[model samples]
Target: MARVVTKPDTLNQLNQDFEQQVLTVPVFLNSVPKCGTHLIRNIFRMFVPVNQQYHDTFIQIPVLRQHVGAFNYLQPKLSWGHLLFSDESAMALRKAQHLVVVRDPYDWVLARARFFLSDNFQGNLEHLKSGQINLEEILNMMIFGIHEKVPSLSDIYTHNAAAWLGTGTKLVRFEELKHHVQNLESDDAEQYFRELLSVLQLREFPTDWRERVRVGSDREQSGTYRDNLTNTAFTLPDQLPEQQRKLVDYAAPGLRNLLGYCD
Candidate 1:
């Protein structure tokens, strides 16, 4: 664990006070890209309007404080981003009850591949605009840089899950949220949803909450990569490259074994 550099005067009281304040402060939801981030956001929208914030890198403390200070206070703020933990981000997390979502890295990679393939994806990167790249190429691009310009894929996904692994942060399983789909029409589903809300300390939802959630979710979005690759007669990788494998391990310790995705 790395030591968080803070002011000397507040060093002793910081951790204690941070833990106490987290429970009451707003929810800060963050996740690796294509990891059911929008699904969680949609669910939260039922209770409170989800505010969008895009801090793509490891932000410094003073700048992060200023960014957070500018958030709209008319409603409960839900600041989200695809950011990894750093001293600055850790400091920002202090003021909010943050939740991070993780998915099987294999699935996560596939989703990103599919996303970039879409013509609607407004990426300025050359690889993204071509639409001729394969899944393997996509993985290569993410791990190694694209033309040595954009940040590497590992730069983002490596230690991505680790960013939110510390104390006072909640981990939401993408699998659990997906399972909710099966029981969406049943009373047990409402109970499950309620349990989720309880975890976030949110208020009770309306009687028609399930319908609202369903309408908000894009059920067809999750497995697009599989469908696309199957149609093109492409095969999934037997194993990730050494660099990519390490990235996943760093982001999610023992993820394959934990998720039963290991060979």
Candidate 2:
């Protein structure tokens, strides 16, 4: 489908793209879904109060173009929509420290696919289990970008690396830090927060935010998609048909191995 070319998406996307030219003034968080970004964003929001001093934009709707505009002066934290590598989004990503969040694609896919059953998704979030759609349609859409890349984060890893591959910025995996900041069994979570805070350069974290670091999440699990996934919840990678598997392999090779699925 051709893009809508509407004013806002185009304008915001364009603004976001332009803002990438600035330096370490803005730290871009290119997040793939289910990638532990919520926890990190919450920590940043809670630590850096949005009073007159700082502005924290985490998952702002419509587009993050407005927040990206603040790239001129150094801000303690900045978070937003995925930083795709289109000619439009190239600017802000170029000067960013390039901290991206990734998840095992298989698990991530399964977790989202289950959204069909949720009341919140309504009919638009179609699924065979929801009784509002056919399995073939969903499968076909997944195999092909049949409708659009609504759910795909779009070459985010490549986008982050394109501007600063050799630079000193780091990429964090969702799975690695899942328990790092939330498992309350030991002293590890505190140490993890200190390390994470140091990385974002936040001096003091809100007391509640610090308490939540090793506790629960800001929202319920996006894992609701699990109910409708056909095979094993964790290993849907193997259940995908051959063509689908090959297609996924072509689009994201690293993801196949990361999710531990056998084609």
RMSD values for the candidates in order, in angstroms, are 11.5, 9.4
lDDT of 1 at 190: 81
Model 1: per-residue Cα lDDT at residue 125: 47
Each model's lDDT comes to 0.55, 0.45
lDDT of 2: 0.45
For model 1, the stretches where C-alpha displacement exceeds 4 angstroms are 1-24, 49-66, 70-75, 128-135, 143-154, 186-188, 203-207, 218-255, 258-263
Q: Model 1 scores what on Cα lDDT?
A: 0.55
> What TM-score would each prediction reach against the true structure?
0.64, 0.59
| Model 2 misplaced stretches (Cα beyond 4 Å) | 1-25, 52-65, 74-77, 86-90, 93-97, 122-140, 147-168, 185-191, 203-247, 256-263
Q: What is the lDDT of residue 4 in candidate 1?
A: 19
Residue range 82-154, candidate 2, lDDT tens digits? 5544554555556554565666554444444443333334443333454465544454454343354344423
Candidate 1 residue 145 C-alpha distance from true site, Å: 5.0
Q: Residue 153's C-alpha lDDT in candidate 2?
A: 25
